[model samples]
Target: MSAAIWLGRFLFALVWGALLANLVWPFPGKGFALFLILLFVLLAIHLLQLLMFASAYRHFVQWRRGDYWQIVVFGIVGWFAILNAQPQREQELKR
Candidate 1:
């Protein structure tokens, strides 16, 4: 689970780095709409992932965290994002 969370975060970091690169690159001035769109969508997914993880983090009793309700909300939203982003897979062992 931590791997999934970290992978998601890493993707977001890559996205940020790419945007910075794009900004630094002296271009012919043509806009890169496709890359921008992909980056935005990925960023959204990563955001949901972060929310889900943060929600889980709030459960640590030692942390004395607040707002358990918000965590549930974030988990729900993250699930939605994952469902939308994931490609359909064949059920190898449907019960």
Candidate 2:
């Protein structure tokens, strides 16, 4: 994987880890509220990305459960990774 993708995955893991930590120990006041807002916003953006690309994905790719999870966590970067990983023949078929 590229460094950018690895960085994105690292950041996503940090955010998820923070949320999980908050659930266990909890953050105080505005911090907790902010974390919740961040979580929801991220989820909404990821969901929109998935929906926007759903048709193209269904047509051109054979996706697994992990692919969906990657999209959820890494968003558009994940989508592009999947696209770039496709065989050259499959990519040409889109043209």
Candidate 3:
């Protein structure tokens, strides 16, 4: 996946991790109830985000099928690959 996509996944994982940790961290008492509520809320938000992701993927796939996104995706991927590959290239050149 793209860097942005990977980073987004990392951040989302952090969110989920925090939510789960909240239940146990900072003591376990009345906050547990609040945490339960928060967990449910997070679940709802997570579901919505998943739906949105699915919807976006569906549209993107459709666009790809039409060849409308090929250039854009290629350019973005090329840009990221080149930018990130520079350090490796320098190392290889040194070797």
Writing each residue's lDDT as its tens digit, candidate 2 over 1-95 gives 67777787788789878977766777998888888788788889998888777766687686656778778878988886776666754666688
Residue 32 lDDT (model 3): 64
Considering TM-score, which of the candidate structures 1 and 3 is the better prediction for this target? 3
Q: Where is model 1 more than 4 Å wrong at Cα?
A: 1-15, 24-31, 61-95
Backbone steric clashes in candidate 1, count: 0
* lDDT of residue 89 for candidate 3: 61
C-alpha RMSD by candidate, in order: 12.0, 4.0, 11.5
**Worst window of 10 by summed lDDT in candidate 1:** 61-70
- Order the numbered candidates by lDDT, best leading: 2, 3, 1
Q: Which parts of model 2 are misplaced by more than 4 Å?
A: 88-95
User: Can you list the residue pairs that collide in candidate 1?
Assistant: none
| lDDT (tens digit, per residue) of candidate 3 on 1-95 | 46674565456567557667876674367876776786787666545544544466553332223122222223233234334555766677689
Instruction: Report clash pairs, candidate 2.
Output: none
lDDT of 1 by residue, 1-95 (tens): 44565565466467567765665763344556655665566557656655766566544322213223322323434343333333322132232
